[model samples]
Target: MEAVLYVLHGSRVKLACEQAISFIETCMEEIPVAIQEYCFLELADPTIEEAYARCVERGAATIIVIPVLLLTAVHAKEDIPNELARVSKQFPNVEMRYSRPIGVHGNMVEILMERLSETGKLIDKDSMVLLIGRGSSDPDVKRDLTTIAGFLKERAGIGRVDTCYLTAAKPGLEEALEIVKQSKYKKIYVVPYLLFTGILMNTIQKTIRKSLADQDKEFILCQYLGYHPLINSVLRQRVIEAGGGQDLVSRHA
Candidate 1:
């Protein structure tokens, strides 16, 4: 069987890792290929190099390196490519393809919509919706956030979606929350634009609780976008694109 190697940005807990595993595994249904392994960029076992070694050992001729990243930051543009070059040298017989980060895809908005509605509260069209991203120094990474926010706006019925950052960028969650509160809207939803639960998500939630308790602002902090099936669909597209399979652009569209 063929193999696909998922290159995830690692996390601290086994649950998050398991989420990544399940995310990719669900995507694997379309391919008659085998899942060689799932590896991490850091903070967990089975790093990318190790996954490549296993793929090479298994005589896999093609491997797809899907970065389970929200944005194409330094990790995807610089680190992943450099590592892929090294992996290529080690496994000359196997060709590897690196895919765009998960953020660039459109299915994410569907997940975001589902996540937003998960609160059982329809986003007030007149209110402000702050879409918080795990910001990055990379321009490409930042651009993806803007694109997603704008897409949500175009979709409508979710209110005016505004962009903000959790870290490493401007207009932090606090600032966005302040903007929304000052506006006529009484309710503000701070949507965490993360793939899984982690330190950042934890910090955001705590900060929200404390801020509300202190200022007595009315805000609802929803959970991070847990391993959604739409994400699984996006991952499959990336894997298929990297695997040199049929055109998947329309599928992603």
Candidate 2:
């Protein structure tokens, strides 16, 4: 039997974890696989090992592991893989395949545009966008986000879009905000390129509140990228590709 194992990044916040679970549950509904299980990489119930065991107990001879990550980072590239390697050794008879993260998709840019529009503010060429990432030492994180920001700028018909990180990368949120404060753009839209609400979202809100309180600029914090339909579509595509289905053409290309 074939099984699909979804590995989430997990969260310290209960609501964040719950949101992830709910989102994955919805995504799983579209998958036709008989044995589908979800587990957290950390800070939540049903660890990867436990979930893998469940798939085996359910008579899954082949397990497809999908990392529910936004970008190609350490967690997706190393942490989860390392954990999988450890667990796979225990199930030598089972064949395991890994899938890619939802990296650099046109739908993601659409999500950003949707998020900006949700702010109910006019996005003019004079307006600037500051996209915030989760931060990673992996250079791919910066490269991919820069590409997404470029896409956002072009597609949204905006003059400029800048990228920053929450941790472990250059141009932290405070520094990015400071630079934007001195720029010519007065109307700034801050979009968190995050999946769910958690400490990072709260931190962004708090920082924006404290830093831009006295500034005369218009700062609109757009919503984080949640379980949007577009994301679900991307995950469906990922699942399809992982299951030895025909490869789909890149929409962003």
Candidate 3:
């Protein structure tokens, strides 16, 4: 039977990894294809090679391998490609394809805009709005966050929106938060650029919450982006539309 392998980027939190898989499972319920799944690279278990091998062993002549990542960061581009190349060498006959990560799509724009709109309703236009991302060392990842923030700023009609990272590189969240505070705005909002729930999110929220105690109680901490109902259909259409090599595996969550 034909099989589609939705490969997750292993998470530090076991629950995060499991959540990613669960998101995909819900998406695949309607697709007629036989679905197989795996998580390799980073944390957790089952390396990509093992998953590819398993698919080949199961008589899957064509395996669609989707890398369930948010953006085209180093791990998504370098690590996944290197592993796929190695796997391709072993199973020369199994047609496999890799699509770009789901980033900056119209639907993603919708998600951000929706969040900002809802938040904007709670605050006055004079209040400075800050779009906080988890931040990544990868420049491309950072660019994605900035671009998304820019889009939301225009849609929400907010005068200002700034991007900040959590760790790695410079300009961490504290620096960004402080800058906004100096503006002496009545309130500030921080949005998580993350897809899954995990320790990084918890830590960031705690830091923000603690800092907010000194400020006006109106400080806003928006929720992390997750598997919303429309997201499953958005991911499905993304893979279906952004096609590459024949038999190339495309996965989304």
Candidate 4:
């Protein structure tokens, strides 16, 4: 039988890792894969090696590793694949295939739109959107985020959409807040392009509340993208594609 291994970028926060595992469990309910398991990339238990072993012990001849990441960062591009390569050598008989990371999918845009609506702030032409990313050293990840911001602007009919980073990249959260403060836009909606709630999300919320408490501008902080139905669909599609056959093997190797 075929097995699906969902790999998430692990977090130091316990709840963050738990939430990711829980989301994968819920996804198993809808996915047709016979054997389903999950593991963290780092900072958590059941590393990729352990998860791969468990899948084999369960009699899974073929294992499909699907990354549950928002963008094509180092975790998706290098780390996960490198780990998988190491593990694959140990279990040569077991067929392993890796799927692409979820990057700027159409459904992801819908999730952002859904999050924006949750803020209860009207998105008019004058309203500006500050899309906050986790930030990456990878230029590809930054480029992908910029494209997503453009799509958000066009689809939501907002006056402007600016991309910012929580850390590591340019236009940090504070700098982005300053830009919003200077803009003529009456309302600024901040949307986190993240998968689950963690320390980062908490910090972002706290910072937003503190910075804009006395400001004249209205800043609406939206919720992070957590286990939404559209997100589930994207994950399910990744698994299906990974399980197609050996064609996916070369992509990761």
RMSD of each: 3.3, 3.6, 3.6, 3.7
Clashes of each: 0, 0, 6, 0
For model 2, how big is the CA root-mean-square deviation? 3.6
Report clash pairs, candidate 3.
64-249, 65-249, 66-251, 96-248, 97-248, 97-249
Worst 10 residues of 4 by lDDT: 244-253
How far is 211's C-alpha from truth in model 1 (Å)?
2.2
Once superposed on the true structure, which residue ranges of model 1 sit more than 4 Å away at CA? 213-217, 247-253
Give candidate 3's whole-model lDDT: 0.71
Instruction: Please list the residue runs of candidate 2 whose C-alpha ends up more than 4 Å from where it truly belongs after superposition.
Output: 246-253
Best lDDT goes to which candidate?
Answer: 2
Could you give candidate 2's per-residue lDDT for residues 1-253 as a string of tens digits?
7888999988889999999999899987877777899999999999999999999999999898989999999999999999999999999999998999999999999999999998899987569999999999999999999999999999999998999999999999999999999989989999999999988999999999998778989999999998788988888888778877743222211
Q: List model 4 lDDT by residue over 30-141, tens digit each.
A: 7766688999999998999999999999998989898999998898989999999999898889999899998888888888888898777677867898999999898888
Residue 89, candidate 4: Cα error in Å is 1.2
Model 3 segments more than 4 A misplaced = 116-121, 242-253
Per-residue lDDT tens digits for candidate 1, residues 1-253, read 3567778888897788888877766766654465457789888878889988898788777677778788778988889889889778977777777788786667888777777678887566555567888887777766888888888777656556778888788788788776776677657777888877878887888777766755544677777877787777777777677766654333333
The Cα error of candidate 3 at residue 71, in Å, is 1.6
Best by TM-score: 2
Lowest-lDDT window of 10 residues in candidate 3?
A: 244-253
* lDDT by residue for model 3 (56-110), tens: 8888876766677767688778888898898789888777767667777667767
lDDT of 1 at 133: 88
Better of 1 and 4 by lDDT: 4
TM-score of each candidate structure, all chains considered together: 0.89, 0.95, 0.86, 0.93
Clashing pairs in 4: none
Candidate 2 TM-score over all chains jointly: 0.95
